[model samples]
Target: MAESKVLYLQKVKNQNVSHILHKIWEHEAISRIELVQMTHLTSGTITNLTQELISHRLIKESESISDSVGRKRVNLRFDNSYYYIIGIDIGRTSVSVVLSELTGNIVDTVEYGTEGITNPEEVLALIEPYVHKLLGQAESRKRKVIGIGVSIPGPMDQRTGKLINPPGFPGWAGYPIRPTLEERFKTKVFIEDDARTSALAERWYGIGRDGRDLVFVTMGMGIGGGIVQNGRVLHGTNGLYGQIGQMSLMTHGGAGAAISYDCWENLGSIPGILKRWSGNGDFRDFIVQVRAQEPHAVKVMEDTLRMLEASLTSLINLYDPDVIVLGGKLYPYLSPHMEAIVENVRSRVFDFVQERVIIEKAFYGQMQSLMGAVALVFGHVQENPLLVLGAD
Candidate 1:
């Protein structure tokens, strides 16, 4: 009975501490009084936890700032400079590695194409030296690395931590990505689906920061989705929540017999859209032709964006998010047509939902995935300072 009571008390204490830490991070720099009001905890508890956090170097006291009436109070801020994060994004076309501070600022980066890469081991081998170089830079700046975060394409088994046959990259099947990195770096590693990571990047560092519910739609070699509900990534039952690529549009085969179905991603993806064009040309040239209103190019694009409008309408109906973020290889090209797409989608959705939802391009542009990987670590650390710092 005593042991059980002790365990219960410990769990409650941890939750309190974690809650306090999150409040400080959310507020950026906050007074103990503000923390007390926000957390609904006793002032004594706030003071003790803040002091403990300061002692552990997770947080620090800032210069005295005067509030209204000139009463000076010391503010507390997260010590983000003390720890570094290594963020890696493994895409079918390329692999990118970044060294970032807990603030989601990238300090260094290296990238390589995956054209000749045939296996998961090769991808890790490509990442290792870049990681070592980034760590050296962090070491020179006296930053302790907290962990490594990876963004990989999905169909992953969370229980196994192995990617199970992601699209485009057959070589990565069954690879123990988490354990391999943890073993090599001698530190904890966190991995998330690429789409989910992109959403995390948006939630923490991109245009979705102000949005309570956000959806990031990706269009590259493939179409994917990442959804954030009330500031947390929505990983539904089995962690397979955001597979929006498979959203069906129509069925094929005989009138009565069922056959393979056509879906949103089939025509909305970059490659799929390009392949549909009757004439062949370079991607950049194709974009220029579309912008120039070349008859064939414009026709192909309008058809694709109409499909996008349908899929986006489906998304709006399903999630009713505050904002929808569009990104990946196809977005820049699609930017010119965004107004039309937005209007078309709005016309089809509910009146109440139409006015509130904003659709915008990703602010981080090409770096969204890498930023997501870094934010994954940032989120984990901010949520559990003691666990992350090995103080628990």
Candidate 2:
């Protein structure tokens, strides 16, 4: 076989092994036959891979035997006690850090609100202490930390691991978040767009688990999107594939109109909806009136939903994904009109594609982004076992 083909086949084998290993990790204990049933890898393949993992000390054979009757079955499981990972999420309003076990369970978490501060250094300060605390906790517990994964809001240079002109963090353009984290934590670091990371988490642990092609649209203070195609989060050139919020729907002429700004974020974001509301109350009160179907509240919501429908229609037509997951803070407002929203989107897309795509709510709710940060590390380690397993 050609060298490229050989490497491709090896990658496929590694992916299969990783999938089976994750299945074993999720379950407290699972037998080889069960692994075959869960991952659809042949029993022989599972046996060989599990044996390799056991020898590498990445996984282990459980002392307790399986309850199968025909043959004695030894169970396989991840060695959670052996290592740890840190997952951090930097949002427009808050920063959260989670310590996760090898199996992807959250051992502990630290959070701090940003309160609208956008300076790059200020943002770093907000998260740094929590990151240190989490790292210290892991050290005290005697767990070796292997990697750090972070979810940041912006366009990132995937190759260089630098944030490039992120909208949420104004002064953070061109910051080297990944390299800084790696140097500070002294571990492998990975960075991904916040919304896309959430989509990854959904694929691994939520509703998208059963489907390979999916899109997650987050309607929050800012609008964001995460698109998954063929079971992987799509990262286009420079890793800016999921910046759906910047896609323009219309153009307007005004003072400084040369900028030609009419992005989906300005049109369909929660803050935009709140700004349009004429009432003298806060967001909580506005939501109360919206649920009550008050006239002004209803009108703003209808317009917001219409704009969202237009943006989402464009996305569905472009990607033709199997599912679209709606999430984030604004979902509560959108939930009451979800049936209509989905129907509206379906009506706008091509007939042949509409019926195949299902619209649903996010499984992890608002925690999706934070959880996704952890999933990123787990995913990296799974794909490259040598990172966690050393030269074994």
Candidate 3:
């Protein structure tokens, strides 16, 4: 058989093994009997799979837990500290790095300001020290580094493992982020668009845990977002799916429905909003001004919310997701007005079905992107258990 075909066949053969591990990890601890029940695999098969994972140190036997009858049962749980995943979030304003265990619990974090630094080599230089620092911390804990995950600005070329003219970072257009990091770390590395990383964060740790469809939006910088449907991030052709900022607004209503190209990002960007709201304050100051009921600040916020209501109405109709999560610098400021925004969207949605869409604030704080990076590696392990098995 051809090499490619052989490799493809090998993946599913161990899918059951990996599935068993996920069940164990998800529940924190479980017994072989529970695994068989959850996975619907035979008791013998569950035994073999659990044994295989144990042999690799991917999971370990937890101490006996007494049941209702006081019978000691051996519970299985992930060897949380046996392996580490490094997550990096490279934002326009700063770079954040974190080391996390198998359970997605962050251990150490490093942050450095970038102030929109886009020079590829300079960016790499800033990241290298933090990466080494976290790796050092992991080694102190006796955890082997398994892989690295990066949440970065996009439009990235996933197939080529390169950045493609990322916004405000044009010079990094052709940088090979994946290969560069893999070479530096001597392990597999994965890069995902920052927005999608938030969606992953939700799927793994936030509201997305309940459902298969999720949309995460960032109101800061520009109106960026990511889509998750059926538990998979959507990377359209050329990896440019989540351009929520550019989603054209329905400027007017009619059969012709006067469409405007003035996207939310352009109209609602930080500079533009502040510029419109008296032109004298940063976002924080603007929030204070709004709280103080300053006319200009109040007016600008109202205007933005009007468009936000329209934008969200359009979003719900178009995507039809189970939930839409909003976060970023602007979201908190909008908290006082969230009820109004939701009510307006509810009243404006196309029909009753679209009105059922649940819009909520982002569950995580600064940890969103960084932890999203952690989710990336955990996702890879689910699909390819060899990361823990020390298989290439």
Provide the clash count, candidate 1. 0
- Best-performing candidate as measured by lDDT: 1
Candidate 1 clash pair list: none
Give lDDT tens digits, candidate 3, residues 40-84: 999988887788888778889998888899988899988874888
Winner by TM-score: 1
What are the Cα lDDT values of the candidates?
0.82, 0.79, 0.80
Q: Roughly what TM-score does model 2 have, to 2 decimal places?
A: 0.83
CA-only RMSD, every prediction:
2.9, 4.7, 3.4
Q: Cα miss at 261, model 1 (Å)?
A: 4.3
Question: Which should have the higher lDDT, number 1 or number 2?
Answer: 1
Ranking by lDDT: 1, 3, 2
- TM-score for each predicted model, relative to the true structure: 0.92, 0.83, 0.88
> Residue 381 of candidate 3: its Cα lDDT?
78
lDDT of 2 by residue, 198-246 (tens): 8978887787655468999888878888988766788787566888888
